[model samples]
Target chain A: GAGVSQSPSNKVTEKGKDVELRCDPISGHTALYWYRQSLGQGLEFLIYFQGNSAPDKSGLPSDRFSAERTGGSVSTLTIQRTQQEDSAVYLCASSRDMSSGANVLTFGAGSRLTVL
Target chain B: AQSVTQPDIHITVSEGASLELRCNYSYGATPYLFWYVQSPGQGLQLLLKYFSGDTLVQGIKGFEAEFKRSQSSFNLRKPSVHWSDAAEYFCAAWRSNTGKLIFGQGTTLQVKP
Candidate 1:
């Protein structure tokens, strides 16, 4: 793909239901990131994947929020027992590498999740 | 910990008028600053970034930003505003070691024709 692609552009689920969001990053990009955008919180980093190494999960809000990157290209973010506060736009971004140089990221349209 | 701050929650400017947006960052070391724009229902697009060298950096769409190290500020500026420039602007700082971005609360730019 020419740019980062995300699935389920919009999802509305009942409370306590689990939801999954997918992301397909640009070809050959080794760095991928997941972010959440809410009404007043702005963009918050959720997770980061760099190659096969362990993902940086420091930003995951809770135990229910988790993510995985398969084949180093496609990524999935799963939220368990969704809460009304979990409603937000989930965004995916990819970068060429993690070098000291400018790390410009390409973002996807994002998936809007609404927990009812 | 690193954080970015955008003071103005909303800014309104008349068409063809000069515009400026203020941003500040808190970091212990040199920061990699960036400005991104988001149109309605669209993804974030990078406007410009400051990694090293010249304090004044030019970006796409005739936008420019200046990095003031002493004040820890990176302000975006444009010579003239257009109707199409109406969008949400975000200021961010990248932690090179961690490869994560800290974004500010974003400023909504309203251009009046």
Candidate 2:
């Protein structure tokens, strides 16, 4: 793909239901990240995957939030038993490589989640 | 931990006016700085970035940013503002070893025509 792609641009689900968001990073990008943006707020780091290394999940708000990247390609972010506060725009970004010591991220349009 | 701060939550300026948006960062070492713009319902677009170079860095759309190491600031500037420039602006920083970004609360710009 020419750029990072995210699926389900808009999602609405019950408060207790689980939802999944997907991200397809730019081809050849070795680093991927997930972020959450609440209304009128800054982006909050959720998770990061670098090659085959252990993912950095330091930013996941709770145990209910989990994400995985398969085969070093597409990634999925799953929020179990979503809460109203969980309603936000989930953004995915990727960088060409980490070797440069400069990470310039290209982002997707994001998946907007609404919990009712 | 690396963090970015954008002081102004919202700002309004007349068209053709000079514009400046302030961003500050907190990190143990000098960190990479960036500015991004986001239109409504759109993804973030990099406006400019500062790695290791001259203090002033230029970017697309006639935008530029200055990295002031003494103040731990990276302030974005434009000689003249355009109506199309009205959007949400974000300031972010990342450590050299990692790809994760710590974003500041965005500043909303409203261009009054």
Candidate 3:
């Protein structure tokens, strides 16, 4: 794709329900990251996937939040038993490479999830 | 605690006037700085970045920012504001030790015609 792409731009779900957000990064980007932006708050890092190395899940808020990248091109973020606090804009970003020590990223429009 | 701060939550400026948005970061050593803009219901777009070299950095859409080491600030500036430039701006910093970018609360710019 020409840029980072995301699915389900707007999602409304009842509490305790599960939801999945998908992200398709740029054609050759080797690094993918997930971020959460709440109303009136700064973006919070959620997770990162770099090439075939193990994912860095240090930032996930809880065990219910998990993500997977299959075939190293597309990624999916899943939330189990969603809560109101999970209502936020989930942003996906991809970088050409992080080994150069620069985090130059291109982002998707984001999935706006509203858990009621 | 290390943090990023944007003092002004919202700012209003008349169209064609100069604009400045302030950002500050607290850290023992200087870190990579970046500015991004987010229009209504859109994804964030990178404006510019400062790592090393000259203090003044030029960005897209006629935007520029200066990094001040002493004041721990990276303020975004535009010589002339446009109505279309009205959007939410973010300031972020990254350090290898932290391994993640820390962002400020954001400043919402309102351009009045």
Candidate 4:
């Protein structure tokens, strides 16, 4: 894809139900990031992946949230036992490379998750 | 801990009026500053960034921001704002050690025609 792409533009899941959001990063990009934007709040970093290395998961809100990147191309964010507070816009972004200075991120349209 | 502060939660300006949005950051080391705009139902779009070089950095849409190290401020400005410029603006600062960004709550801009 020419730019970062995310699937399921919108999803509504009942509380306690599990959900999965997918992201397809730009081709040849080596760095991918996930963020969450709550209502009237700034974007919060969720995870970051640099190539095939272990991802930076420090920002995951809790153990219920996890993500995986396969083949260094597509990634999936999984939320187990979703809560109403989990509702937010999930954003995915990709950069050419992490080590490169002046790396501007290209972002996807984002997926709006609503936990009822 | 690194943090970004956008004092104004909402700002209103008439069309063709000059605009300034205040942003302050606290970081132990030199900061990587950025401003991004988000229209309703849209993802964030980077307006500009400041890493080094001249204090004043120019960005798209005739917007510019000046990095003031002394005051820990990076204020965004535009000579004249159009109706299309109405959007939510966010200021962010990245931690050099971890490359993580701490963003401000955001400022909603309203352009009156």
Candidate 5:
């Protein structure tokens, strides 16, 4: 694709259920990022993956939140036993290697998750 | 700890009016600073970024931001704002070692005719 892509543009799930959101980053981008944005709120960094190095899970809000990238191309963010507080628009973005200064990122439309 | 701050929660500017959106950051070492704008039902688009060199950076749609290292601020500005410019604006800073991009609460810009 010409731009970053995210699946399940809108997802509604029960409070206790589990859901998975997917992201397909632009070709050749080495840096991928996940962020959560609640209504009227700013983006909250969730995680970052760069190349084959260790992924940064420091921003995950809790143990139930996890993510993994496959083949350094696609990624998935999973939330288990989701809570109402977990409802937010999950955004995915990709950028060239950080070594490339400024680290400008291209963003996806985002997947909106709703917990009921 | 590093943090990005956008003090204004909401701002309103009439069409053709000049505008300036404030952004500030606190970090130990120099970091990458960025401005992103999110339109309703749309994703965030990068407005501009400052890593080093020139303090004044020009961005798309006639938007520009000046990085004031002394004040720890990178404020977005425009000579004249259009109605289409109304959107949610976010300021963020990325720390190289941690690869963490911290964002502010954001400011909602309302354009009135």
Candidate 6:
């Protein structure tokens, strides 16, 4: 794709329900990231994927938050037993390479999740 | 740890007025800095970045930012504000060794004609 792509631009789920958000990064990009943006709050780093290395999950808020990238092209963020506080926009970004020094990130139209 | 701070939560400017947005970062070493703009319902668009050399970096949409290493600041500026420039602006920092970016609370710009 010409740019990063995310699915289901908006989602509304009951509290405690699980939700899945998808992201498709640009072709040939080796670095991907996930972030969450809450109302009036800054973007929070969630996870990073670089090649086949173990993902950097240091920013995951809790055990309920998990993500996976398949074939190094598409990624999915899954939230189990979602809470009302989880209502936010989930953003996905990708870069050409980790060592490229051109750390310019290409972002996708985020998925707005509303946990009611 | 790397962190960014955008002091002005909201800024209002009349069309054609010059604009400036302040940003500060905390990092042990020199860090890569970036500014991004987000229009309603759209993805973040990179405005500019400061990596090395030339304190002033030019970006798209007639935006520029200067890196003040001494003050640990990288402020975004535009010579003239436009109605389309009303958007949420974010400042971010990342360690060159690690590409993870730490973003600051965004500054919302409102342009009035």
How far out, in Å, is residue B15 in model 6? Answer: 1.2
Q: Write the per-residue lDDT of candidate 3 for residues A24-81, one digit (tens) a residue.
A: 9999998888999999887998988887453468889999999999888899999999
DockQ of each two-chain model: 0.87, 0.86, 0.70, 0.65, 0.81, 0.82
In candidate 4, what are the lDDT values of residues B28-113, reduced to their tens digit?
87778899999988888999999899999999999999999999999999999999999999998875456566789899999999
lDDT of 4 at B73: 97
Please give the CA lDDT of all the candidate structures: 0.93, 0.92, 0.92, 0.90, 0.91, 0.92
**A1-116, model 4: which lDDT tens digit per residue?**
98899999999999999999999999999888899999988889998888865447899999999998999989999999999999999999988876766667888999999999
Residues B47-104 of candidate 6 have per-residue lDDT tens digits of: 9988899999999999999999999999999999999999999999988576688899
RMSD to true structure for each model, in Å: 1.1, 1.0, 1.5, 1.2, 1.1, 1.1
| Candidate 5 off by > 4 Å | A52-54
TM-score of 5: 0.97
Lowest-sum lDDT 10-residue window in model 3 chain B: B94-103
Give TM-scores for every candidate, taking all chains together and pairing residue i with residue i: 0.97, 0.98, 0.94, 0.96, 0.97, 0.97
Error of 1 at A82 (Å): 0.7
Between candidates 1 and 4, name the one with more favorable DockQ: 1
Which lDDT tens digits does candidate 6 get at residues A1-116? 99999998999999999999999999999888999999989899999988645347889999999999888889999999999999999999999888877688899999999999
True-vs-predicted CA distance for residue A27, candidate 3, Å: 1.7
Encode model 3's per-residue lDDT on B9-101: one tens digit a residue: 999999999999999999989989999999999899999999899999999999999999999999999999999999999999887665567
Better of 5 and 6 by lDDT: 6
User: Compared with the true structure, what per-residue lDDT tens digits does model 5 show for residues B1-113?
Assistant: 68889999999999999999999999987789999999989999988888889999999999999999899999999999999999999988887777777899999999999
**Which pairs clash (backbone N, Cα, C closer than 3 Å) in model 4?**
none
> How does residue A67 of candidate 4 score in lDDT?
92
TM-score of 4: 0.96
lDDT of 3 at A90: 98
Listed for every candidate in order, the interface RMSD values in angstroms are 0.9, 1.1, 1.3, 1.5, 1.2, 1.0
User: Model 1, range B1-113, lDDT digits (tens) per residue?
Assistant: 68899999999999999999999999998789999999999999999999999999999999999999999999999999999999999999987887788899999999999
